[model samples]
Target: MIEKQSLPSAPILIESIRSIGYSFETAIADLIDNSISAKATRIDILSIPNEEPYIIIFDNGNGMNKVELEEAMRLGSKNPNEVREENDLGRFGLGLKSASLSQCRNLTVVSKKDGKLSAFSWNLDYVIERNSWSILEYSEEEIMQLENIELFKDVETGTYVLLKKFDKIQASTLEINKTITEKMSSTIDHLALVFHRYLDDGVEIYVNNRKIESIDPFLTKNKATQAKRTQEIKIGESIIKVKPYILPHYNKLSEDDLKKVGGKEDLRKNQGFYIYRNKRLIIWGTWFRLSRQDELSKLARVMVEIPNSLDDVWGIDIKKSTANIPDIIKKNLYSCIEESVFTSKEVYRYRGRKENNSEKYNYVWDRIKTRDGYEYRINRDLPQIQLLSKNFDKDVLIEFERLLKNIEKSFPTNTVYLDVADGKLKNDSEMSAEEIDELIMAFEDSLNKCQELGLNVIEFYEQIIKTEPYCNNEKLKELMKEKIKKYE
Candidate 1:
C-alpha cells in the first residue's frame, strides 16, 4: 500500500469553482451569511460602478486576528458536519472564498481586533502565476492603501471586504457601470428579503448609505393576515417549527403591499414553505412536492424554522439556496400543507362571496363554481335590470337577455387575472364630483321613467339604492333615500 499527495492545479480548480452557478444576488447573500455568523450588527455594502468598478462590504462584527483571517481565507476552513454555535450560519467554510472569487479576480479582507489591523488578499492572477494557493499579506503601511480599510479604524472589532477586477462581469456587458448598478439594485432586494428577519431585529444593512427595509413574506403585521396555529415536529433533541399564514385577499392588498410580497406576478410563485435556518431564510416558495402551486392556494405561506443541527437530515447544499426534505419530514408536513392550502382557498372563496351573499349590498355579479374553477356571471335578476326589462317588448326583452349573457360570456377573465396579478388593476377610489353629477342625471331619468310606467318610483329608488355602482356611492345613495322619503 502506498500514499501519494495529489494537489489540484490552482488556476484550473479556481476557474472551475468560479462557475458554481451563483447569480450576482446569491453571491452577495453568501458573503452576508459570513458577516451574520460573525455577529455583525451593522453591515454596509458599497458599490462604485465604473470602468474599474469595486465593491466593499463592511461589517461591525467580532473581527478575527491575523492567524484566524489566514485560516478563514483558506478553502474548506471548517468541517460541514461539526457542531457549531446555534447562531453560526457557516457550513462547509467555502462561502468566504467561493462566493468572493465567484464575482471578482481580487478578494481583499481587512480586519481590526484588539487595537491591531490585519489585511490579506487572494489575487487569481497571482495564484495562477505562482501555481500555488498563496495569499498576499499586507504590512500596516501597505494595508492603509486598500479601499475602505479605514472603515475598521473607528471600531474595535470589524471586517472590511473589498472586491475588484470584475473580469467576468466586464466580459458580458459593454456598459459596466449600468450593469453593476443593476446588479447592486437586485442584490439590495435579495438581502432585504433573505435577511428580513435579521433586519427586523434591529440589524442595519445599508447599500450606498441607504438603509434597506425588511420584506416580510407573510405580512404578519397586517391586520387582515390570518396566522394558523403552529405545529412542532421533534427529531431527537431538535424541533422544527411550522407556522402557516394566509395573506390578505388581493383586494385588501394595495399596490405597495403587492410589491412587498414579491409583486403581483410572483405572488403565486412565492407562496409555499419559507424555510428559515435560525431565522435566516434559506429557500422559499416551494411545497417540497407536498402540494402543488395553484391560484386557490397562492396566498398560503408556511414558515418552517429548522435549526442548523438538522442540516444533515435536510441536505442543505453549500449555497444554502436548496434543501431536500426527508420522507419522514415530508409526511409530517402534509397536514400542515393541506390546512394552509384549504384556508387560502377559503380566503379566495370568501372574497368572491363578499360580493355575492353578504347582507350589505346586492352584488350585480354572481360567482359560480364551475368544473374547472369559478366563473363570475352578471346577476340579471338585479332589481334595476329587472325593472328595465318590464319596459321592453317581448322580443326586445329576449334580445336584452341575450345581450347580458353575451357580456357575461365575453368576460375577459384571463386579462383581468393577469392585470390583478401584476398589480396593474385599476384602483377603485371614490368617484369625483363630476362623475357623481353624471350618476345623478342617470338616476333622475330612471326615476322619471318609473313614474311614467305607472311603477312605484319610491320602490324603484329602493332597489337602486341596494344595487351595484349606485350602492357603492354614499352621496348617490343619500340623494336616492331623500327622494324616497319625499314620495313617502
Candidate 2:
C-alpha cells in the first residue's frame, strides 16, 4: 500500500475545530493552563465588550521567540506521546488554537522574549477565502499597532493571546457585550477552583483587574474538616496520590464558610472524586461508577493527584474535562471510598445533637447499623451496668449479658414508627419530688456497692451523674452532686 497525498479542506477543518465541545469558561481555562505551565507567577484576563468584541489573556510566563511562537500557533504543535516536563499541563497541544477559535473566528498571539517581540494570527475569513492553511505574520511595526499589544510594553518576557470577532456568540445573542461579560464572570469561578492550589501557593490570577481568591473545595483550612491520611497507589514508574476529605456537617458550617467553596448548592454538586493533573483540576463531582452519589456521602470529596507521565494510563481527553479510571486504580481507591463515606454518614447520624462524637455523649441507647439492618440496643457502658458487672461473678455476668441481648433484639421498632407517623409519640412526664428522692436513694446504694467491691467511689459517683434517668432529673442531679462531693 502506498500513502497518497490527501489533505483536509482548510475551511471545513477550521469550522470543525470550532465545534470541539468547548464552552466559554472551559476555553478560557484551557488557555490559562498554558500560562501556568510556562512558570508564570501572574496571569491577567481582560475582556473588551463592544460591537466587535475581543478578549486578551496576558501572562508573564517564559515567552517564546519568533520560531517558537510560529510553532505554538500551529494546530498541533507537539505529539501527545512525546514526553513533557513534569509541570507541563499540555496534552494534545491543541488547546491554545482549538480553544480560542472555538468561540471566535480570528486568533492572534504576540510574545515578548529577550527584549524582542513577535506576533502571528490565524484569520478564518482569510483561510476560507484562500482555501489553504495559512497564517499572517506581523512585522515589529505591525505588531505594535495591534489592539491591547501595549500590555507587554514593560514586561521582561510574556505572551499575549488576543481573540477577536466572536461570530458565534454574536449569532446567538442580540447583546454581544452583555453575553461576553457574563461568560467572563463565570470563568472567574472556574479558574478560582481549577487552580486553587496554585493560587494558595502564591500564583495570582486577575480578571478585569480584580484579583480572584482561591476557592478550596476541601476546606483544608477549616478546623472541623476531617482530612484522612494520604494514600499512594503505585502504577508502573509513577505514584498516584489520594487524600480524602470529609466536609463539616451542614449545621456546623457558617454562611461565609459555605461561600468559600461555593454555597450549599455546590457541596452536593462537587462531591466525589476530584482528579488533578499536576495541581490543576481536570475533572470532579464523579465517582466513575466505582460508587454512587448518595445524600449520606455528599460531604465526601477525594483528591487524586497524577502526573503527566501517567496521562496515557488515565485516558485524559483533549479538553481535560473527563477521565477513565482503570480497574487497578479503582481497586486501590476502594479503601479510601469506604473510609470517607463512612465518616460522612457518621456526621449525619449525630447531626442536631449536643455533641457530635459518640464517645463523648453518654446515650442510653445505641443505634448500630449492620449488614442485615439497624439494631437498637441498650448502651452497655451505662453506670448502672458497670456497677452491676463489678458485683456479679462470672456465671452471673454471663446470664446478665444474655438478658441484655434479648431485650435489644425485642425492640418495638414498628410500634414506634407507627406512633411517630400518627403524631402519637408521647413525651415522658416530668419527674415528681418523690421520684427524685427514690432515684437518689438507688444511686447512693449503688455507690456503696461499688466501694465495697474495692472500685473507685469517686469514679462511680461521676458516672452516676452523667448517666440518663438521673441526668434528666435536675432535682435528683443536684442532690446527687451534693452527696457525691463527700466521696470526692
Model 1 clash count equals 0
lDDT of 1 by residue, 1-488 (tens): 79999999999999988888788899899889888999999999999876689999999999999999988899889988789899988899898888889989999998888888888999999999999998999999999887766677678899989999988899998998899999999998899999999999988999999999999999988878888889999999999999999898878987878899988789899999999999899999999777778786899999999999999999988888899999999988888887778768767866786776477677778877554334678887787687788788999999988998899999876566446556698876588888888877888888878878889887777777777788888888887776566567
TM-score of each: 0.75, 0.79
Error of 2 at 24 (Å): 0.5
Please list the residue runs of candidate 1 whose C-alpha ends up more than 4 Å from where it truly belongs after superposition.
Answer: 360-488
lDDT of 2 at 260: 68
Candidate 2: deviation at residue 411, Å?
20
Worst 10 residues of 1 by lDDT: 367-376
